[model samples]
Target: MYTSDPTPTSTLLDAAQTAARLPYPLLVSELALVLADPAVQVPPRLVQPLPGGARLLIMPALDANTAITKLITFTPANAARGLATIHGDVVVFDVATGQRKLILDGPTVTARRTAAVSLLAAQRLAPNTRGPLLIVGAGVQGKAHLDAFAEGLSIKEVVIASRSAASAHALVTHAQSLGLQARVVTNADEALAGCPLVVTCTPASGVVLSTLPRSDAFIAAVGAFTPQMVELGPELCRYVADNGTLVVDTVDAEHEAGDLLQAGLDVTRLASLADVIRADAFVVNGPVLFKSCGWAGWDLAAARTALAVLPH
Candidate 1:
């Protein structure tokens, strides 16, 4: 029923403005519904390797009325050049007429949805104890997660850990500007100890941290989407698998998450994010692990919310 001669394009700033208008809880709830709805269709993502070890990923999802596709490129070598490692765009379409609806900045969509999803998991998995928050990697995802959690949760103290001390200090300064008590730590173990909530947002191919989190801590790893990259080590995975809940955004995560794949976790035992959202008796007994490899349905849901709030 909708058609346009030229599709409207939304910049990353526009997407951020729209995100600011939509409450975090609403965004998470919408994504949960899309994940639980039997009518929604999300096919497996397609991957293609490019020259110089870069890779292109295509993810498509459709509900009864709308459809969206996200095209992403991962170039690890770009980091050395002071560029973003991942970049892409999302295309939204009207299913009824097969007409283009909106095109959104992919990195912005990814950062917001990823953090929102992690917050949803943290709300469900994090213990009731009040402790310092630890964020590893001071990149876009790191900053996004900090903002998302700060908006919804009662975080009193924040600790930032990054390979670069300057980056960590800068993030701490940013957090302080937002009225958050924050500090920087060079040691991963020192940062992980006694933290009630932890989120890792790095693209490290090997284990980023070897320290074990507190028994009641909830950790969210948002990096290492491919089979060759990992942020959490095998010991951490085994600890959660043995003593706590291990949840992922989608069942397909077993194939995409390098941490889980390398950890040799039993895919059949992992629970989906939708399951956690829908379950009424869910409880975490110890440290909890929530791994997200990104999903097209989340991008579609975010774009839809943005479109509804954007001014005409």
Candidate 2:
């Protein structure tokens, strides 16, 4: 347990070290615990606008044993600047003593935990579990999802689509290196019919994917968390809300899920991940959309996973 060891250590883990500790399977398991625990407290994240459309995110969460605050910056234009779009640290604390325990690379934690959350949703709800995973937007989040589905879902093939050819090809190479059959496509919609499992992780305010591959297709929309940004087409969002199972990572999506809100969806009427897990139910014969707006509880789960694997 996180509280068993009381001593505090200010060990600061870099991105590589952080990623080394939080593997997909372990992260996914921890996320389940976080989602189910009634004591876990995640207040609405505070967002501060920055110059040039970037923003600062402040997310804090705590349970009985541990507390964490993830401070990160979202700079949408950074990719073209050849720098990371997200940069910051996750500061962890021991709840019993009120002392700082550890620090982790914020982007690593976010990417890994977010992808793990999507993978967990897929395992429970997606009809196409093992597949030619179609990933749109070959950025950090895209790569992380590919790794997560490959390792957690045992995916054998991947098809990637992105505006940047270099980024897309690089992700495909990474997929092949992981022993998955990988290819690049000019457009994601063109590949949709063949691949049932799709992930859209771009920072677009417009639609990247507007259609479903099949009746039981699973789409994880991880990008465009703000009200002004959307990755899924409005019609597609409405179709899922009306006919299929639409799940959000948390209720925060009611205010933050751009695609759904743009489609004029009453997000409050949609089920959440916790609701789905608690009810132990899913849409049996229709499509599924997992809308992930950022939540602090996921960061707390990542902190727990890292703490568990850290050397005692």
Candidate 3:
């Protein structure tokens, strides 16, 4: 029974406040329901190249009562110039009534949902995870992950690593400012050395962390969604398929995941987080990895959470 206004109502601060209030377990359960619900259909993203270090990605999600469309633009050029790398808006419409209910700030929504996705995945996938938590990439996603994860788990140590040592140092400073045990590391090897759970938020187009020093750890690769971007190499996929569980947001998306596809990896058993959450898990004796290409269901879940917390 909602109608679209002449002007969209949601703002960044509004979304942020809502995001902060949405409990981690609630977000996780909502995402699980969205994925497992047969009425929801979220297809693979359709991406388009753009000019000046920008790319356009379109994502669509469907449920029994609603349809969501998101158009996102990534412009590293803009980011370098102190602009948001991602900028866009989200449209939510009632499937039954065909009434557009709301339009929201896409960047804030994306950041919150994506971080929530990572934390949820880590909660389900990683075990005995006391840290020395290592985070690769200190970009927006990386920062968001740290912020969200801190809200959900107890962290004793945090190692921030990036290609730019300065960026790593900055993140270390930020973490310390928040009273976290944190420091900067050099590269993947150093970051993965003793960390029990590592999250990569880099936007590398090729393999960033291929193989780890040991199999006693956990990883959540949060970057890379296209047919050419991957934060880890094929070794990680092979390891996951052989010794651990490899749950993806979607199978079709992983098939197009540049690292796995290029490495001739056949990820035949791609289970959604919903499936994993609902099913009984097997005991694992080695490192477990979860890869995410980002999913539209997460956006809808985050949007709903934002709506619940924003002032009416």
Candidate 4:
């Protein structure tokens, strides 16, 4: 019997390219399939802190022959030092033989996959939008979303709102350097009213944005994975449930999201990514909201995709 060649390792740039070229609809399709497939199991938070406030998150996903295992570690100090806040590596292992095939840096993959998930949500939830997209956080995830959106959507203007005005302005300059129209906003409401699509990428105990544009607006809250953390208000959860369709990354994690549970948002009522994709069309009888805690299935989808593309 001949053993297969070793799995090939790739870089974050490889992941970013995969994210950029992969059609948005197809990513959502993969998400739907991954959600329905019983072989997939996403474990709860596996975070461990090392020296110097550095942290590690073990994210594992098993989808039949494809098993994507990731070890993510980072430090805010590292980020301040012009390094990565989230860095480490991902290993694609063949479950049949438990053979580690490929390894890639976690920071790039993390940022790319996170942005891909956001784009999937945006395509499905946000309507035919134009101009002034508001990004709540200016960190890695926030910047990744801005970069991905600039490539995928027709966003003419971008307004980044962060707790630090300087950081927000730096992101604006960075985005402009990338040749996209951008600015910084210190006021949340002003940014929301100016932009129809609002993406919250920060971690806050309370809502960062309230009183969104009452029109056909879309909000995608990508931060706040823990029960103690949330970026949107309890009212926003009600807004999505009452006015628009609420899409969750996983129904299982909904109970953990404080924004949803505190507001008494019915998890059963919310649709899954599969539900959204398999459906023929989206009927927005009301406002739409997507609360994503970043499911492991997404990492699986991206990791699997990466493994398939990388040479072994």
Provide C-alpha RMSD values for all models, in order: 3.1, 1.3, 3.5, 4.2
Q: Write the per-residue lDDT of candidate 3 for residues 179-275, one digit (tens) a residue.
A: 8999887767656778887888886655678765356677777787776777787777777767766666566655556656665766555666666
Give the per-residue Cα lDDT of candidate 4 at 239. 72
lDDT of 4 by residue, 1-312 (tens): 112345543344445554443444445456656756777777775868789756677888876776777887756566457665676767767767777766655766677667777777777767746656889988888888887788667887888999877779889998898777888878877667667777888745467887745566777787776566677877767876877767876775566566677677777667866677667886665666777776666777766665545343
Better of 3 and 4 by TM-score: 3
TM-score of each: 0.91, 0.97, 0.87, 0.82
lDDT of 4: 0.70
Tens-place lDDT digits, model 2, residues 240-291 = 7777888999999999999889989999988888877777455455888899
Estimate candidate 3's RMSD in Å.
3.5
- 125, model 4: CA deviation in Å? 2.2
Query: Which residue pairs collide in model 4, if any?
Result: 7-101, 243-286, 243-287, 244-287
- Model 3 ranges off by over 4 Å: 1-25, 282-285, 310-312
Ranking by lDDT: 2, 1, 3, 4
Query: Which lDDT tens digits does candidate 1 get at residues 111-226?
Result: 88899899888887788435578999998788888888887789878899998787789899989988889999887677787687898998766688767777788889988788
Q: In candidate 4, what residue range of length 10 has the lowest lDDT sum?
A: 1-10
**Better candidate by lDDT, 2 or 4:** 2
Among these predictions, the greatest lDDT belongs to: 2
Candidates sorted by TM-score, descending order? Answer: 2, 1, 3, 4
